[model samples]
Target: MNKDQVKGVGEQIKGKVNEALGKATHNPGKELKGDLQQAAGKVQKAYGDAKENAKDNVKRNAR
Candidate 1:
């Protein structure tokens, strides 16, 4: 996977952890931040997916 994909996945995992921790500790700020981070990660992952797809399409067309 590309860097973006890797980073995005990492962020998502981190966000999940943060969110869970926040919930357990009863911290709305951390929970909200985690939610935002997770969303950003999803976007980043989608962008990476699109990049990979486009690359594959180009290669396929060239072939």
Candidate 2:
């Protein structure tokens, strides 16, 4: 796991908490923000996964 992956996962967890809190408090703005944060986190995680995969591929091919 790389930095981006770790951070992405953290962001996702935070977003989930915010979303839940917003819902419990009836705040649409916060809920929307949480949704966006979650989406961004997903994208970041995917980027990290791709980066790791590419690195592995390069190593394998260099052999």
RMSD of each: 0.6, 0.6
Clashes of each: 0, 0
Q: With candidate 1 superimposed using the best TM-score fit, by how many Å does residue 42's alpha carbon deviate from the native?
A: 0.1
Instruction: Give the 10-residue window scoring lowest on summed lDDT in candidate 1.
Output: 1-10
Q: In model 2, state the lDDT of residue 49.
A: 95
- Candidate 1 residue lDDT tens string, 1-63: 788898888889989988998999999999988998899899899988888998999999998
Q: How far is candidate 1 from the true structure (C-alpha RMSD, Å)?
A: 0.6
Which residue pairs of candidate 2 clash?
A: none
- Tens digit of per-residue lDDT, candidate 2, span 1-63: 899998889889889988998999999999988898899899999999999999999999999
> What ranges in model 2 sit over 4 Å off?
none
